[model samples]
Target: MTGTRFDPSWFEAHHVNLSATERRAATLTTRRTVKKDWQAAWLAQAITCIDLTTLAGDDTPSRVQRLCAKARQPLRDDIMAALGLDALRVGAVCVYPTMVAHAVKALEGSGVPVASVATGFPAGLMPLSLRLAEINYAVDQGASEVDIVITREYALTGQWSKLYDEIAAMREACGPAHMKAILATGDLQTLGNVYKASMVAMQAGSDFIKTSTGKEGLNATLPVSLTMVRALRDFREKSGQIVGFKPAGGIKSAKDAIAWLILMKEELGTRWTRNDLFRFGASSMLGDIERQLEHHVTGRYSAANRHAMA
Candidate 1:
């Protein structure tokens, strides 16, 4: 979804109530307990919304191919059949720009989109021209989605216009490929800054506003996610445009997955729980989820090695 025009005033007066946000986030996991079949259903739903990622310095073509294979069949055949399903696939496979071609070739005919992290991912310290070039390169290499990092310095210094301009340029570079603006909230310093950055990103045409790059000191947290979700809700109310949310970094385990699903359901309704509206930026989290599903099906847990990602 391409976004609307820049509007600064939409979030000018917005400030997060730290304690209040914390209080609400605290209740999401405990508010309602979905056990047995219901819990399995939620976990299965979470599997489809995952952006199965492997962004590392040691990444290789073979590794990416294996990752794509997992994306194609996240759950074992026995588990899928026991759950009474035909197939289960992840939302997308995310990789670095240079790995886009490899992922695309590997995931061919699998109905899975390849997402590449561009615009100097993780740090975004490169020059503007180079960053935009990186995005173009990834798209040219067959990336269906591009995750671009915003210049946190711009937001930290309160230069909203600058942030909008750069992100807009990145969005333009993305062309038809979906753009996910990675705000790296861990470095933004405050929830208020997080809200404004989310507004600016959606205004600049980001299809999704991500919580982090998964490299920050403090990655995704419930309070930060709540702030961004509220901002997206406000933007939707004012502009009538819906943008997706992705909370990445340090989100592992089946319990964490359910907690995020709960957050989306309680705050934005069932629509946000879909892959098109919400995604979990995760890697190891899938293994734990598979283990839990196995337990639900067989009444016994399996070893982590049995559910290897790649």
Candidate 2:
């Protein structure tokens, strides 16, 4: 009877995967997100400001690397001179997996958390077991947060089930630490696709949904961030689960950071804070924020000043 009633090709074609109603319900969640008020959001910057420092890049120019090393030593000694560094910061230094130890060593007594990217990041092309081993290795090396990538190939192929399964397995491998699922929105190709990927990411146990790996071409853009914000806002309503959002790549200024701030306000409201649910995966951004903060307080930007700590 079952065989008589089912046709293989017909079953594949007629799979009632998600009815229009269910699809819409999965999206456009009912819970209202914190309305976007740039002034209000910026006003609340007292506690929401985070100094995101990510150092993974494609073109790791030796000149810049030498410059950062030079900056690191003096910056470590001169941090007290900076306004933000002098204040209570949610101390964190994010870096590539290979540099986890370097970052951990950089902020030893500063109480900052160390975050590193794993699982064949940017491209997400390695084997699943290898990705798990990378996570375990990073944790073993003392990284508090592990940013992993979803299997974009599967998601792009419209294999939602495979995408969900991969993310879930990665989440399980994270084991006690926070898992930031980099959606790689730029590669996903559409806001609609971004939303769908975001949903699958959260459902599969992503503690945070990130925008990019900073290695891709169209890393982080406002439209993509907006798409992710809307998705998170909707997911929160339907599942009562709060997830963090991180926009990395091509983010090089404080102005860009402010836009993300405003977007989070519009999408998630007051829940967007330092520890609760917000982070920027950045490399050159900290120096920029510090420069802007100095410009805000001093009316001038320092072209030569390369490190916030310095």
Candidate maximizing TM-score: 1
What TM-score quantifies how close candidate 1 is to the native fold? 0.99
Model 2, range 156-259, lDDT digits (tens) per residue?
78777687788888888778778889988878865666777777788788898889877777898766776677777876776677888888888776566666
TM-score of each: 0.99, 0.75
Clashing pairs in 1: none
The top-ranked prediction according to lDDT is 1
Candidate 2 has which clashing residue pairs, if any? Answer: 36-266, 54-282, 91-112
What is the number of backbone collisions in each predicted candidate, taken in the order shown? 0, 3
Candidate 1 lDDT, tens digit per residue, 1-310? 6667777778888878999999999998888779999999999999999999999999999999999999999999999989997988898999998999999999999999999999988899999999999999999999999999999999999999999999999999999999999999999999999999999999999999999999999999999999999998998999899999999999999999999999898899999999998999998999999999999999998889999998
Error of 1 at 66 (Å): 0.5
Local distance difference test, each candidate: 0.94, 0.64
